[model samples]
Target: MLTPTVVSNSTVRRSSRTPAANARTSTRCSNCAMRHLCMPQGLTVDELPKLEALICNARSVRRGDFVYRAGDPFENLFVARSGSLKTVMAHRDGREQVTALRLAGDPLGLDGISTGMHTASAVALEDSSVCIIPYPALKHMCRETGAMQDRLHRLMSEQIIRESSQMMVLGSLSADERVAAFLLDVSERNGQRGYSHAEFNLRMTREDMGSYLGMTLETVSRTLSRFQKRGLIDAQGKLIRIIDLESLRRL
Candidate 1:
């Protein structure tokens, strides 16, 4: 069982109880803003109640705190209800490598399903909240509803695709190409979630981005500067704007 922490104001405390245990109300899947991203598209009237009951808890994590650490026993999966987080794995030498960035509507802990233990730690990039979906209850619901089972399979497929893309980026791309690809990828993802794709704040620090892209911090900074100088992008601190989308796509 994973023990998730919740933040109230600036105070951090651990909790073993479900998130709904101390709450007045929980968001129902049918009415949630992120429903389109995580919920099954076609559900019968009978299935909606089961889906809502499956996600009875919601956790609030402060910035810099972990949602779940690597190696923790996996009891539930999570959906990012708001804000963002990064999943990282620790090396034998004690260095942590950033593996994936999770935005609002993204699923976390899918990597744990096979091993029954989390493979990476998920830390909040900013103050974030996640809707907790207990896997045992979810599996029971899946057995009862084919739509729910299909949704779970789709989430797993998406995780695999993201990992494959990262491998390709790290293995074949030059530093410049890698950075461009990263920016483009972020842009597309933001657009998918109904945010401004051309301009958005990149919450990840340059150092963290470097770790995820398999580049040095200096290399990441230098490449961004080069992109800005070439009029391909306008970057101010962590805010990035794609100035020439066509030109960036070609790179």
Candidate 2:
């Protein structure tokens, strides 16, 4: 069984120290901010020293960078520190689908755990930084640390559950329900990151949102317009402000 650890927000903040300083001080390890979400929930003082040494090399990627392309060899686990990313799948016919949109604190590339190769391409939707935890180093830590292994299992399980739920939502929900549920879901997730749940931005485009929601672009635009007219939401291009969260939930 995996034990859940509660990492303090402060500890997470401390992980984002610059690489230069992180190389010198085990106590002041870098990548804390990004690791907050992906790392074990709570870490003891003893564990921190070992973890800092294992996670020595780190890099930053800007918007539009391809973290990894589909079919690429996978060697590291990626954690989004800030901004958003989209995993896309392109067919031989030139059709493209936006499979997933990940925000700050979300982990990507775990879906390739079994295959050892990425199934979709991960690209930053905005200026972003990601912490790359090499698989060998991570595996070594997990083998030596019970808590670290537990955290890895929990993360993998969570990913499975989320993907399963998304499939169910796509299969069973009506168009209106899907759109409404998507808005509510995004709002709640954003809220977790300390942003206003009712008033925040939509980083993905309408077409991409429609693709994820299993609706056409026209339907997405029309539905959004209806929400605006009904005062359910206020959206201007990518900026969406949820005016009536309750009503959105009820829908």
Candidate 3:
């Protein structure tokens, strides 16, 4: 189970990578690269150790494997430690929609909080790894101090902001406008994670992108071709280079 069950000091607090059997390990929050973008961002140095004690290391998830499924019990929140994953929601008519794409350093499983069960399913888009944050342990930890409590609220606020942005994309944008915005958004987010903003590969398929943007796959293709003809972007297979970010934003 990815859900947290905080063991006593005699358990996970032992020296790491020991030769003994039954050894359990946790990552240090102070040393995490994503600490500033994650729930532990505001934790002080003194409080970092406490936060570290709450996270449990996890094994890698293979491509096409599911991290969790809709209707499953919500025990933990998942962080994309490496690679990427997609969240899917199934329609009553049996169609599935890709709700979101999660990259390294991104958080997942937040939608499970409302009903204590997951509302969407997460599948690894590539071989991936996740940090499992035990929800029970996290909630208990939040109650122990003020900083983490505020951090929890901030995390939720960010989620709300992301949801709002997604809503705007779906409700207001035209097909070409949607693709333009999607590329720019992904590029900006990728840059934040230390990748090249203007040049990168598209991890999501055209079909997935169309699903996210509420456009048909053919529409996505035509729009890209149009963007290419206009010199707004250069697409060679899955790789894309935005030649005119200003034009894209204007679109």
Worst lDDT run of 10 residues, candidate 3, spans 4-13
In angstroms, the error of model 2 at 199 is 1.3
Better of 1 and 3 by TM-score: 1
- How much lDDT does each candidate structure score? 0.85, 0.75, 0.80
Cα shift from native, residue 242, model 3 (Å): 1.2
lDDT string for model 2 (1-251, tens) is 33222121222234557565455433224445545566675678889778766653334456667777777776777777778988888889977788888887787788667798878888876666665566777899899888899988988888788778889889998787788888898998887777789887787888888888778999999999998999999998888999988988888
Residue-pair clashes per prediction, in order, are: 0, 5, 1
Tens digit of lDDT per residue, candidate 3, span 1-251? Answer: 24322221222224334445225455655666666667555567677787777787644677777888887778788788778888899999999899888888888888888999889988887777777777888899889878888877877898789879999989998888899989998899889888899998887889998888899999999999999999999999889999999999999
Residue 74, model 1: Cα distance from true site in angstroms: 0.6
Writing each residue's lDDT as its tens digit, candidate 1 over 193-238 gives: 8899899999999999999999999999999999999999999987
> Stretches of candidate 2 above 4 Å error?
1-36, 56-58
CA RMSD, predictions in order: 4.1, 8.2, 5.3
RMSD of model 3, in Å? 5.3
Residue 153's lDDT within candidate 1 is: 94
